[model samples]
Target: MPLLLLVCFTLLLPPSLTAQQRPTTDGPSDPPARNWYHQLGGSVGWARNGNNDFGPAVALGIGAYYHHLRQFGGLVAGAGMGFELMNADREERLASLTALAEYQLGKRALRPLLRLSGGVALPVGSPGQSLDSRRAGALLHPSVGLLLLPPSGQWGAMVLDLGYRFTRVDFAAADNRGGSFEREVSYRRLTLGIATRF
Candidate 1:
């Protein structure tokens, strides 16, 4: 009888100890510390116009950016300025200013992102001497990119962005013949650029 009692106690002892020993898995773990970041980058790409009068063009840009990380994604905002040079016989340049936003995919060292930006484009220098009319207009830009973060260092992260940009310009002027006309110019831009975050 004592042996039977001893065996029963031995079996119950393990379960009781296990019930007390097991750690609760439902509690959340502490999150890592968050940091604010700043980035600067430049881009070069091709630009095309809706009007056939101007041939293909090349564009150059520079920008500054800032963001904060969240659980799933982060909020990104920045400003950029750039110029587009058309292939027209005369010098035709367009200068631009933009505000940007991005939704970052994850908090990992490598993250994928989606971005949207909008701003205005102003005609820079002088309009081509041959042009009838030229004026500044609104711009829309969208892109997908990747962010590569440093493990834990002061060098900052690197970013690569691939996306499309669009802008429209309106014009009204009289030709040398004094015949007046109004027209609109549209630009479709394809661009890729890299930036570093600090």
Candidate 2:
């Protein structure tokens, strides 16, 4: 997250960028308040566990955000919370929530996007019988997507996101044979979502 913030500040603090990218009627994406917006979105994708299909993966998020200065690329940056869950056999498999820092760049509704989030994930339902303990897991997610915005009146737009979710996590536990194991695992997902601006 620090790395993403640094990139934001790098563009924010530069004197040279303060006058180059002003928005006009011809166009670009604005601001402090007029530039601020809120978004809510959900996604569907596939989840995998140990070389097998873990069934469907679902994700959701919501947040209010502000944009950088026009000179600083008028980029949108947001702070929000999101959840990802895995489901299989008509039951919940895993669930997690993570705090996020997000950024998107472009002059119009169709923009490229990137974000990062991290936190611990807990097994859902049966697997959660034991507490995660210190020997638990983490969800370090890095995502990239294309943001497709279509105007809806004046103050907002509809958000359509097509993206890839990179799921990074680890688990530690003792096997039935009295041996313990720790390994990093990943779930790759192709996700799409619809969001609204306010």
Candidate 3:
């Protein structure tokens, strides 16, 4: 019996020693916050008025965007300058500022993107002149588009956007009674750009 007890004690002591020597683990810790995607490039996009009374027109400008989540979807604000031609009756030189909200696909390295934007434009000249003018007001435009993510390892990042904007303007010449009425203008464009992660 004493021999058996000694043997049992010997076995138990090793286990105890091993237990004391082994390190304790606390599983995994929290992960860091996700990084944001940004883009800087030139775009020559088009616009189609909402009224359906007009066709697609072209606008040239440089655009830069940063993604954020808040009111509206994800907010995006940008500015562009270009020549705006209405029907055969009118055309104008203009500058625009815009803010938009977007819904992102997933948390993957490269995410699929969808966005909506609302912004205003300021007319530079009298209606269609490139010179200059003191007449300035606000024109509202809204748009929707798709953004493609670049491959993290070997994939490409592309931004393909199609959006429609609505705007209005009132000038003394546009209204016969010296009073101004709101004219509905539509805009549509396909913009391709690239994005990067920092």
TM-score of each: 0.58, 0.50, 0.42
Tell me the tens digit of each residue's lDDT in model 1 across 30-136: 12244445556666656643344466444433333333323333767766666666334434456777777887754444556777878888655345334455687
lDDT by residue (1-198, candidate 3, tens digit) is 332443344344543232223343321111123333334334444444344336544453334444332322333333333334433334544455555555644333223455555556655444333332233445443333333333223333445444444444433234545554444333344444333322
Ranking by lDDT: 1, 2, 3
Give the clash total for candidate 1: 0
Q: How accurate locally is residue 93 in candidate 2, as Cα lDDT from 0 to 100?
A: 40
Task: Compose the digit string of candidate 2's lDDT tens values, residues 24-65.
Answer: 343433322354466666667654443435654353322222
Error of 1 at 60 (Å): 9.9
lDDT of 3 at 55: 56
User: Model 3 scores what on Cα lDDT?
Assistant: 0.40
Task: Give the distance in Å from residue 30's predicted Cα in candidate 3 to where it truly belongs.
Answer: 16
Off by over 4 Å in 1: 1-38, 47-73, 86-90, 126-134, 171-183
- Predictions in order: lDDT: 0.59, 0.48, 0.40
